[model samples]
Target: MATPYPTPISLSKTCIGWTDIGLMGSPMASHLLSVGHSFSIYARDPSKALQLQSKGVCLINSQQDLAKISDIFFTIISGPPDVCSIILGPQGVLSSLNPGGVIVDMTRNHPALAREIFKPARKKDSWSIDAPVSSIDVGAREGRLAILAGGDIIQWLSPLFRIMGKHMYVGEAGCGQSCKIGNQIVGSANPLGLSEALTFAERAGLDLKKVLEGIRRGSAGNMIMELFGPGGFAESLVKDLGMGLDLLESEEERAVALPGASLCKQLLCGMIANGDEKLGLQGLVTVIERINDIQK
Candidate 1:
């Protein structure tokens, strides 16, 4: 049996804050509320956050206000640029963040960016953690996300982490992001492999669903098929692949060769360039079938 995690720390005295409530963030915030962790939030479009408001989560008017009242702030924004602008920009979190407060960034951001943000936050006697989450919106809603966190505040935030998902402390400030990049590399590559196999199977006149079921019972089965099948739209995977490409660009400076990830990136870019970016990982089959001159 797996070891049971320690009891969660009471968050009654800690004022939590969540911003950028998109698909993933909304469910995550709701999970916290369900566990009785009262927190505040700031939404760019107030209407998107009305459901949260109805749950009695205090809605603040600005990032500064959100920062002022929060002892532990969470940001689940888009990417590096948004993370930088929201935390370092004028009237951003740093402007009014209390000394010794912790900022948990759950964005799938670049590790270097996470390190950069850590510097300034540290200078002001605050802390930052790169705790990018794993799992889709559905997983977030079910509180089954595997949260990879890197920073000094893991001990203090363990209780809250428990409420969200199975949490792992990867390492220092940017390690969580580094792990996320690695995750994307595998995640993107897996779909491509599945696409090729499925295409080959379909061309051989095999039942795709039956093949998936049999494969799932073996090591060949994976989350990609479980969540997206062969033609569903995987918005998160597309975004993660884009972020992986950015990481590769940075790695090139160090003479790192990620040929596999690079190839997957090219394939995904082709899908996007062809206006099929909205299609999920399974959609890669469309591109593969086209390349092989086979009809889906």
Candidate 2:
């Protein structure tokens, strides 16, 4: 059966509040403010938001203060714990969110936590939607992210969603996080496979550029190869994969099998051990090289 989506309402007059003005969130909030959303921000590290403030975005001192002024709150913090702290904490957004207000959490969090947030929002006559985005720094800056929304209120938030990225209404609360976990699982596999292949070709003394060209034109061609060709940070990937594996372990009934993701996690961990956690996904090739004793 199809789930019903609320009709999108005009948000022309809605006041928006955003938090966590980091690499991804900064640009996302900028896009909103650029489009004239009457935007405000609550930044823990105020320095990160100085430019936004200079551009006329109201920088509130606390989430409580933000809640009083914002009709719609958007957060894209680091993990589940921070999500809880910002939304459910003593001075969190929900502590004083106006009735009929909405909270859109764009963090890639545990699915269960997303659902946990939904209940209180309902009790207060507000709404919580989990809408994790899939994109890197450039994509976020360019507003080209792929957003996965898990809630019925998505339609009502369509105007805002359109500015951030292309969004898919997945299901009830928490489903967006679940889908993002699956996305990380699937996304991790491609880059790992590409890195392995590249490492092999390099070890065989093949011309890497020629080999990459052939791969790009061949059956193994994929978006990961195109976007990263051979580079991306392993730290974020490690966190995402760890969360994915934990989710699988917790859901015993599902019995899903994804050995590639596990192996990818291991290789990424190897990258971290080698002190290359700050390096890109192509750095995984170094791990493979290390395994074969091929010095860079």
Best by lDDT: 2
Q: Top model by TM-score, which number?
A: 2
Q: Give stretches of model 1 more than 4 Å off.
A: 1-9, 230-239, 248-253
Candidate 1 achieves a global lDDT of: 0.80
Per-residue lDDT of model 2, residues 1-296, tens digit only: 01112323344667788999998999999888887767789999999999999999888899999887777889999888899999999989999887788889999898888988999899988889999998887878899989999976788888889898899999999899989988888777877778778888987899999999999999988888867733336887788777777866775326567788889999989999989898877677788878888886
Off by over 4 Å in 2: 1-12, 229-232, 251-253
* Pairs clashing within candidate 2: 232-280, 232-281
Q: Looking at candidate 1, what is the lDDT of residue 168?
A: 97
Global lDDT of each model?
0.80, 0.84
TM-score, candidate number 2? 0.93
Instruction: Write model 1 residue lDDT over 89-191, tens digit each, in one string.
Output: 8878987887877789999887888888899998988888899997777778888988999988698688788888899999998899889878877777788
